[model samples]
Target: MARSDIRRSAPSPRGGKSSKEQPRGWRLFFRRLFVWGFSLALIGVLSLAVAVGLAAQSLPSYASLKASQNEQMIVVRARDGTQIVSLGPSYGKWLPTAQIPQVMKDAILSTEDRRYYSHIGIDPVGVARSFYVRYQQGKFRQGGSTITQQLARTVFLNNSRTFGRKVREAVLALALEWKFSKDQILELYLNKVYFGGGAYGIDSASRKFFGHPGSSLSLPEAAIIAGLVKAPSHYAPTADADAAVGRAQVVLGLMVENGKVSADQARGVDLKGIKFAQEGGQNSVRYFTDWALPQLDLLLGENTKPIEVWTTLDLKLQNSAASAIKNNVPAGTQGALVSMDRDGAVLAMIGGTDYVTSNYNRAVNAVRQPGSAWKLFVYLAALEAGYTPATEVVDEPVTIQGWSPHNSGGGFAGKIDVRTAFAYSKNTVAAQLGNEVGFSSVASMARRFGITTPISTVPSMVLGSNEVRVIDMTRAFAAVSARGKSIEPYGISKVTTTDGEVLYTHEARSSVQLVPENVANGITDLLQSAVSIGTGQAAQIGRPVAGKTGTTTSNKDGWFLGFSSGITTGVWMGRDDSRPVAGLQGGHAPARAFAAYMKVAVSGRPVERFQTDMVAPAFQISPDDEASFSGSPDEYYYVDENGNLVEPPADKTAARRPSDAPEDPAPGPDDANRGGLEAVDPPPAASEDFLNKATGKEKSDGTPPN
Candidate 1:
């Protein structure tokens, strides 16, 4: 061996390596370095294994993975399919793997975990890419979680950035893959994941955003929902529809890239086609939603599952009602209004001027004096007892049970017919009619009218002293407009589960005719006179109106209740504390609000005139009677407790303007109908327990307790 010829001679630069023959040191050094490197790698792998085992010990069992949930949600929708509000965490009915829309599955798979089917719960390639991205970007910018890993995190582990949490997540991921099939994992992830806006599942997200169920989701809708999993709040369709759609666009692009969706299908999606659901925030529709909630218990007996309350709320009318109150009612006063169809389906309701500030629904909740409005029942009772609109009555002061009621004008008119007395809303005449009709009969008439509130059986009740809810009063009037058919105000038409299972359906409490058609006709004529040419002139719209006005003592409460041929509504204005609103009167704020709301509410319906066939008057007003009356044909008289027409005193006022009418205490620019809040027993319908449990069923409008 020639040292000069050997390759070791090249290492002569280091004197020790110059001896090429003795190469063991260099070989030994290389061998030891390799051995140390292998040993460190093995130690690192063992340490990771041990760490993974420790993490596995702390993780929850995959056997317990399930579609967990919190409280059930209640979704209240309008008659026209408008979602009014969602009560709690909304979870749609669970969708089985086979039932899940294929587009949804494709969207999720393409955008979330393209290699999900091929992976064992965790994607090594994805993890490596994620770490590489972090290394390149110098921060954790994106997650590399597979669908299974994400499910494990959302179901079994809390989202955390700690290394131990990551290890535990990985271990759970493996366990989930072992325990669940790919389809099961996908189904679990979709049905249990949060999609923001208190929606916990795809079905709920579909309904929450698109106003439909999971089975009805479109491609765009599915993509939008699928994108929510990454950042629920950031991509919630209800929050920012544009951002959600933008995220959906990205998802669709990924779907197309992954061959899950066709390019043509992706391109055809219209940006304008997608609309996010928005309900119950700042929009006055909250009034109806807030009202219809508690009734669920009475409706379905402590329902806890997700349900849809099919309500009779007309969004159009509801908006109109809110606008009417907010635009017409004075700043310091709160206003409430409820409108219903002839069948008693509540079309719209306004609990207060601003429901956001005050949730107490004055429409169905508050019971106040319905001054002259109570005259409806009294007059109805008189008519029922064979009294006619033309029946003569004295306007003189009358005393009953030690209670003497005077004309609001402070002076009595000479002589007036029954129609005139009712039209002018003369308080003295109403008291006399109540006495003559027999307070018992008057109370009975009110009871038959569906008002269930406590009625003062006292003599003053005839003078509009009964405190009654607006709904009860409205219903009393509704009976008149409906020709004496029983009317019950109902907000919910039906209750159903998310799976379309029917729970409860509303039925009219009573089908029995409470008032005779003739009496109703007579009452309707009086109401027509009150609105057409009488005190209710302020409530008149272009179409015919039959309504009355009511004001409590000291103007503490003002109310106006009216109905057209098809729809009925009641309005009340007052302070929540029962304090009087200065200058408030039924003919003013209430009438104005009623007119404003009806102008929009009925504008879309055909003009249906009220029934014109009024009952025959017992004392028919003849042209000859107008020609020759007993005392100065202009004389307005009053009826005593015995139903005798009493002559007016010499000092009695001859002619009078309606401004000082007792019922409409104050006539503003909106002077016409003035309802005197009369304390009366609520008509029978007001106390319908099944329906009334819904505070909103305070439920029908009134002309009686006005």
Candidate 2:
């Protein structure tokens, strides 16, 4: 067949064109392929658009994001509004983009996103380069997150490095870009980003790292802070100044490359002139703030607004107390002081000398034996048991159950009245009286006086063997100063919101009458004697003061608890590990500290004297008062004639009259009988003693006939 006929038979190769038009068949075939490919590409684009729109629906609304910007800071102040400390996730005032320094903005843009102004939430070219570089490195080495993307991640999304989280972050970034201006996005990012050391914003980071506001930051300072966006803690100037300086240099180099700063300008910057904020020792009231923070939450539940806590702490007194401890306390040993008013308002407290070294609140938390300070309760129990200040008790060595308590100086003072024994801190007399009144009675008496610590019923308890906190002891002593009304120590007087809404006001009132007025007056008289002429003589403040000195066994704890009509102060000095401080004693360092603190604490206060009634109560024995006189025979007795038993008159006044029995000779020094039991007035004469004398059955020795 002819060639033209063959081509025409093959559908004419392009509708009957010549062989020169054969190339058009191939073009037509390619054109149809391009049409199908274009349709598939459009369908794929539509599918991606649908998926992105669905994911964007799950993002937080713009209003919710705006509402979350109110981060409240808790500001704690003393009673006088002196700033003690401020605490929160972010601890400074928020700043707008206009308030931020231009240097900081330039540094951030150069180091983080150079195309921040030109991009719409994302830079495709930067992202592609970042991905290519990451793929070449075989690991995630760089991030392409723009500033807007970072703000979205910070304010709305979790910091998860996954494909899904990145996708969500990108979608949220676009949403933020659509809803807010670039300046608004930048402000949110600057305020919400975390800049280590518990600082969460540019303002906090600036003040924390530079000791100034963000508006005053210099070029290098801004560069250093901008470098922290990559790693805040690792590059924090407070922790490692060298690393932070290096990071700032890197940021400076980037700024130069991005044309934000010239190379000459960068070279003129001095990183050394940038003084990092001095770390530590800034807040002098951390101990007080630490204690008051928990109470803030307790008083105002779930507070979302800024709160102003008006604590009872006196900044002057607190500073003085801390200084007193720092200067007076030994180097190796630790000390704590708590000062409260008659109403149990804790005015000044120093839990430790340095809060930066340790935060343990020894004043509120340490429990140490009160030693002889506990004898106040014992003597109070004795007073309640019908024993008067003139009641005579032997101060010789005495044993109760298996425990024999000796004096601090290991020698008996012989026979002395209860007042003298207490003033001199006679351990033997205290133990004997504790035994006569019962140990449980003394413990109950302590509880009545607001000693909430656990009190054991052992005989040594009268010598302050039981452990107690300084705050508890201060409260108990304050009750005594308050004329026997119970008291509870408090630090926070009121808590209010920044808007003047009152949340709590302390209304402290006595829970119960801890001690009778008569008992309180009597105890006050004895304690006054303690401060005036006894072991607590060092605690005298020229005004009337009542206090007790306590030295624990082995000098493990030394305490001086005292109070005037105006204030109650307690001082404790000891090692934290319970190791005895060499040469430390209650009357030495602790009493000195107490006197030092009170000298300043009560300088301007009106001096008032304690009520003193020296007249002793008339003693009369009642047969129904068995518990008061339930001691053993060797513990009490009546005068005998020729070693024969005889009962005396019931009236104690008559029994005090001259005894008919021959007076014994003066006791010799070597005689163990020097401190022997003394005869006391007895009840009306009974037939049992008369019968013994009538039968001429004389007792051989002082021992009772069995």
Question: Per-prediction count of colliding residue pairs?
Answer: 58, 0
**Native-referenced Cα lDDT, model 2:** 0.75
RMSD of each: 16.0, 12.1
Evaluate model 2: give its TM-score.
Answer: 0.77
**lDDT, candidate 1, 365-399, per-residue tens:** 78788888888888887775556687666676556
lDDT of 2 by residue, 493-601 (tens): 8888756788889886524445445567888888888889899998887888899999988888888989875799989999999987887888888888888888888
536 in model 2: Cα distance from truth in Å? 1.8
Superposed by TM-score, candidate 1 places the C-alpha of residue 2 at a distance from the truth, in angstroms, of: 68
Work out the TM-score per prediction. Answer: 0.64, 0.77
Report lDDT (Cα) of residue 501, candidate 1. 91
lDDT of 2 at 232: 83
* Model 1 CA lDDT for position 642: 20
